[model samples]
Target: MGFATYQLDRTNIASALTGGFASAISVNQNTINLGNQLMFLGVIVLEIPSNVALQRIGPRRWISAQVFIFGVIAALQIFVRNRTGFLLTRSILGLAEAGYIPAAMYTLSTWYTKEALTKRIAVFFFGMFGGSAVSPLLGAGLLKLDGKGGLSGWQWIFLLEGIWSIVASILLISLLPERKLEAPEKTISSDEESVSKSEIWNKATSETISLRIVWKTLTNVYKWPHFLATACVFSTWSPLTTYTPSIIMALGFSRIKANALAAVGSLITLPVIVFFAWLSDTTCKRGLTVMLSIVCYLITLIVLRCLQPHVGKWSRVGLWTAVNGLAVGYHPIHNAWIQVNCKSPAERSIIVMSATAGLMAGTQIFRSDETAEFYPRGLLIMIILAICGLALVALQSCIYYVRNRSNSDSVEEV
Candidate 1:
């Protein structure tokens, strides 16, 4: 999903920011922002399976369903030209991709103890870096095909890229393991696993998440201050995924050059993505790792708004590069942290899906108003969110301290 966005956003911005093109387009900021919100519509499609399918269909059948669905979506892009066809293809792809992130993290939860979950999450989220790194390369390559065959290369870009996702879905199923739960005995095979996931969610989740129980998990999710704080951090971090190239253009770079520089930052994240995951796993300091990452992000926003306007191309690239690498780290920790705090698997799925939904509900919180001008004002707002996140982190730390401070007597006796 991250890779798809990287290519789509890069290509979209490349076209939008080109001087001779799109000068006649007269849509309001709301419309363009609405297009961006289509991403969340995409998210909704993806999260449905994650929230409802894993336990309902089970992993084996659901994954097999996803693989079959992936091929169909890819093939649809092969012949479709109308908006309806295109939208249907994307919405289906969205549903297929949606099952991945939260599902992967939740799957990781089953693998490691709580202390080790954060690192696993960081490794999983390295896809952002991987996607970012590859997106520009893909975009820059695709831009070369722009005028070929009287069809926009962007169309071909979509068609060809779907293959990658389809192939990936197949390979990944072989790698993902399904553990036997502490429930009634039933045999699970590769083919049956996806269907069984739905069984877990439907037949199983009834205990904690029936129509009556759903509200308990749902309402309790928002009752935590940490979840709200984390949402703020995530909502801000989102633009880095979808709008980094836009932000770079705000600093007066050409679209292609801006995207290429975005790649530079994308490249810088590789080591951090690997090493940070390792540290989070080893240390169990998921929240602390996130706090540090957000600090980098806060500093990046400051640099983009304040220093970027004044910096030379050489220095600007350096700053934006740092921004890309640092900005992505906050998410893995938050993804893991939410699950860690939840008392049950049912609640964990609820919190992950709900928080992600809130992140998608960005139109209400930080409405994207500036279409042509990359609004630096948005950065100011997000910075405040980051600070609030820090405050929440501090509160959590103090809570832990107070709870454990009195343990010295028992430790000494032992």
Candidate 2:
């Protein structure tokens, strides 16, 4: 629900609902991009600290507080009269939202084993698409209320969505469960038992931030290899989402039409994601499924980039739908792929935040104001990143293959 509100605002540019904002604040694409960068920068900077707070304070209080704070921030966006206020609110919202995904995933890990985790993550992660699926249509409808009560349509969008988030946060505070922290060491083997126990004892005894724990995670997380690979793979899709509506508009659709069409594209992806998620779980081949999803994205983007201005409208829309459809499935599969490989709660929390931060970093590369229409440069950069991501996935898969073979050999010899 928090994400839905976030997406609603994030996607407003394509809906042209931000025309009011542009006029009110004398804003431009460069200013908007700076606001976006600030938000993600907040997320990147605060992610680990926020997760540490989640560990200390507990999810029910910490997560719900964040939701409530962001809800307040969302409502306050209406009062942002200048670039400074705008950037301030964006940074606060990013900070407010920073730990949410990892927190939720951490909560999920507590309830489900690795094998059963993917579908659960999918159900939760799908909220992003659900919010995205509704945003364009919601913005389009809200845009019609531009003149009501002396407020602009964009203002209405912010006000109403903010109201929704506030209500949702209240309910979330009531409904979210608090769990007791267990020693994550219990899940690992005896070979590393001594170190795991010492770490667990320190965490349990010292509620304060442990530099040792942080350093341990920082050093060993890099050794995982898949962590950076996952970050790279995840980063490839992050920028595409923020400007989806603009991309559609660039394909010759009017602003409102672009939003409505973006809605249609999101709707198309929902079931595709659900199906691929199910396939990933049942087949027990998340790595392969994620790789295929990326391949699909690469192909769609290449086609979209190569298209002529004279291309049929439906053709462009079809490609758009296909591209987003493939994009949605990657998260659940990749997330599950990462989760199962991680041996403890600490590793999962750290890696998830790092990967997500990598994604936020990728979004900074796409500048909306750089072009009035179309994103040739951005798309080309994305294509290159996608290919790099494919290479990383292949390398990770090879590593997995080698590790599995080595493990089998050891077991057989013993």
Candidate 3:
């Protein structure tokens, strides 16, 4: 629900802008894009620190607080009357949302083993993809209430979605579990049995991340490929999220219909994500599945770039749907691959947050001027980035394979 709420808030403006949002604020597409850039900037700057704070404060407390703050800020978007207000609210919202995903992922990592983590991570991301699928539909409905209570349709979208987030935060505080510090065993050791109940309670409630751990994570060379690969691939996905409705509207659909139809691709993506997760788990080949998903998306991009001009309207829609549907199919599998390679909880948290920061940085590829051309330059940039990402993934796999083989040879010699 938290993840979904974030998506809803993040994309609501994109959907609303097509209806009455731009006129309400007296802003143009460039102003909106600048606001988005500021939001991502805030997220990138605060991502690491937010995760570190999560470690010190505990997930239940810190994550819930973040969500509650996010909800408040999202709701406040309804009151923005001009460009300054829009940019300010977006930046603050990004700060509040910065670490929630990585913190939740870190919490999940503590509970699940590597072999079982991908499926669970996929399930968790259902909230995000589900929210993306639903946001436009909900926006379409709420947009009809344009004059209700004297608020614009976009205002209602922000207000109601923010309230939902606030409610989700309360539920999280009541139900989210603490970290599982140890695996289950058949019997307790005598020394463990001798520990006091007070000590056990304290251990369960408190966690501390040190500066040394942070420094180590910053300097880890092995993690850079994962971060870079995520940045490049995720950049390809940004324009779709922000422009899908407008793209569909250009096909001669009504604004509301465009919003509704934009959801088709995200709806199709849910099952595809699950299938990849299942394949990754069943085959025990994380890197292979990640690469395959990326290839699938790359194919769609190439076809869209090459054939979109000659295609009929509905055929164009189909192509766009395929592109959006396949956008993030590799994300969860890639996340699982990165998590299993990390050395500790602190390392995983840092690496995950850093990777997400890379993703935020990539969102800048799409610009206001390029939207008229259906982002030809953006599409070309995404294609280039996707190819770079594939190379990085392949190189990382080779690095790991060679390192593992060398270890095996050394053990055999010993």
Candidate 4:
């Protein structure tokens, strides 16, 4: 859904649309804020209904709708001028992109056995990695604005992707196989489905749960120390992803180089993610994996903040760019650890999604008051967030230590 019109580049978009004191393209903070609100609305639209609809209407139709939405979102870029239209279109993008990652993960999980799950997940997630790697090249190329038509570069970025997305939607509709009963991903044993069905019904019908299951489930996460720490650890992951371009820009690199390096960072992330995920499987320890990742992230932020001053001196700021790449695995490891350890599917589904959703608080914090300029405030917040994440795991380790000594059962240790 990032087949988007609202350009993230500061100089590019800022120069294109300016009406206020904020020199950033987000010149009108309120308008920018409103557009962001639309983006979040898009996130919610996907987060909630995507899985539910797959169960009812099926993936074939869902994928179709997804492509249709992205296509329209792409097509609409030419006409979109104000923040309202941007927000409205981004909302569509959210809904459209919502199905892809989860559905693909579920399918991979179903199709592969536990031993093979790692490879399967890697393959599925690799789609994101590969797509992200090429996205910048594609985006920049689309933005060249040199064809016979005199469209804005951003306009070409939108329109070309929209057409591609629609074609994909049709292919998905024609090719997907129908399913009589739905379970997780592509693999569902009938017996497992039968058992799962009862559990779902029981949970649904229970008064204590039904009264406010979502609220309860959300609160349930806070009650546990592991959940709390895990959430905190996960939340600080965005600095590298969201702020890296700005970080590199602060390094005083050219916008052309900065955008190009962003793609390189994504390519660098792929292996680090896979290596860490594979390591988690090998070690059978999620906490250590998370702890190590926290350290890497801490190093990344501190080094980045320190190096920002020296960037003009370095001459190789682009080379240091891979530091963000180094920390990328932290998230994939954390996520894979959660997926591997979460025993029951219901618990897995809710907790995993919540952990992911909760972590997005980082976005709010990262983007907050930075004006999408230098994220000094954002970096400070990230440093704090990273420390808290470390403390979370440390605290959990302490709790696990005491509880295990008292009960002689270490099974629950995260």
Best by TM-score: 3
| Distance from true location, Cα of 216 in model 2, Å | 3.6
Model 3: how far residue 253 lies from native, Å: 1.2
Worst 10 residues of 3 by lDDT: 197-206
lDDT of each: 0.56, 0.69, 0.79, 0.53
- In candidate 4 the C-alpha lDDT for residue 265 amounts to 67
**Clash number for every model?**
28, 0, 0, 4
- Error (Å) of candidate 2 at residue 326 is 2.1
Candidate 3 residues lying further than 4 Å off, grouped into runs, are 180-207, 409-414
Model 1 global lDDT (CA atoms, 0 to 1): 0.56
- Which ranking of candidates, highest TM-score first? 3, 2, 4, 1
Writing each residue's lDDT as its tens digit, candidate 2 over 39-80 gives 777776777788789878877888888777776777778787
Candidate 2 runs further than 4 Å off: 1-20, 180-210, 221-225, 250-252, 368-370, 408-414
Residue lDDT tens for model 1, 335-399: 66665555555555556554455456543333456534345677677777778877776566555
What RMSD, rounded to one decimal, does every model reach? 7.4, 4.8, 3.9, 6.4
Error of 2 at 133 (Å): 1.6
TM-score of 2: 0.85
Per-model TM values vs. the true structure:
0.73, 0.85, 0.90, 0.74
